[model samples]
Target: MAYLFSGDGGDSDSAVVPLVCLQPFPLLLFASVPVCFILSAALVMMMKVPAFCYWFGCLFCAGMSAEMKAMAMTILYVCCISFLSFSLCIISLLWVFCSVFSAFFLCFFWVLLIVRDCLVFVWGAKIQSETCSLDSP
Candidate 1:
């Protein structure tokens, strides 16, 4: 339809497209780095105490009932598994953050190199033209 193409060149209202900025993605990731580290450290520390307790209980609890021992062992195993999983999750987050940060810098440096080359080419041409003109005169 002609209306689709001609309705609002400048004045009439239309749906406005929102600007999406990606500049803050890396900054948000950087802010999360410390949080990931702290969480992983806390989980690791918590895991150590429970794991030591679980082993110690197994070693010394010869008279404990089978059902109670089984329940206790299950609880300890669950705790250890959960702590390890959480620590692994934090480690993976850190890995992702580092990868994204590296990629962002790699792209930024590539763009910088391209712009620098363009500027150098432009200036070199300008200088060469100026010298040629002076030599002719």
Candidate 2:
């Protein structure tokens, strides 16, 4: 029993179903984004569990299925989790990078460029000091 509206500005007691509920790809896809993110974050944290217990759960799945449906489902779940977590993490990092870059570009970017130029002038050239001479071989 769902509410259906009539365009005549009147309430009609008719069961007029909307097309969205029938073909829900767009809605489902929108819903899956947050669902996958939450489940993937949980799955990532669950990786801290001991391998012995994790393998035991997987072996239990193997024993439960003749066609390997249970095992396949578990593997699929793991793969989806890994994919979602990595993708969301990457997207968030990129978003942060873009936000920071935009903020700098909006303000203080010229100051940073000036500082870099002053450093270059004093040091003669930009140098790679990643290891700070600790990893020199």
Candidate 3:
């Protein structure tokens, strides 16, 4: 009971690590820390540049009043956000799905697919709105 419940006994001279400390759970947790950080960094990178383009195109494009620019920006954001939400949900479903039976690498493929589709979407919408605004009477 002493070894399981307490960290040290009267013979505290032992150099060995504790049984609990040597478990795989701790190792897995520490291992997952870097993966979490990497995943977060990737999400940030995914959002950042699109944000830059969103702002730049909305603010810098000529012949648009503040209201129109705001509306276009809102539309762009809605589309991007909806697509992201949908993709993540799909990924979550996929995670439950194939993680039960197969390798984890398929998630990456879906992520790439979403990223490509999102980029295409956001940029296409941005361009289309800008063109329509320019073509307006």
lDDT of 2 by residue, 1-137 (tens): 34333333443532344545433444454565687678777665655443433454666653454456545556666876778867777666665665565556534644554565576556653244544565787
Each model's total of backbone clashes: 0, 0, 0
lDDT tens digits by residue: candidate 1, 21-134? 323454566676677667756645654553444554556546667676667667766775676677667667766786787668657755665676677679999999999999
When summed lDDT is taken over every stretch of 10 residues in candidate 3, the lowest stretch is: 1-10
* Residue-level error in angstroms, candidate 1, position 109: 0.9
Give the lowest summed-lDDT range of ten residues in model 2.
6-15
Give the range where candidate 1 is weakest over 10 consecutive residues by summed lDDT: 1-10
Q: Give the TM-score of candidate 1.
A: 0.52
Of 1 and 3, the candidate ranking higher by TM-score: 1
Model 3 scores a C-alpha lDDT of 0.54
Provide the lDDT at 57 for model 1: 55
- Tens digits of per-residue lDDT, candidate 3, 55-117, equal 445446466676865675566566666756665565556555544433334344445556766
- Candidate 2 vs. truth: CA RMSD? 25.7
Model 3 TM-score is 0.34
Best by TM-score: 1
Q: What is the lDDT for 43 in model 2?
A: 64
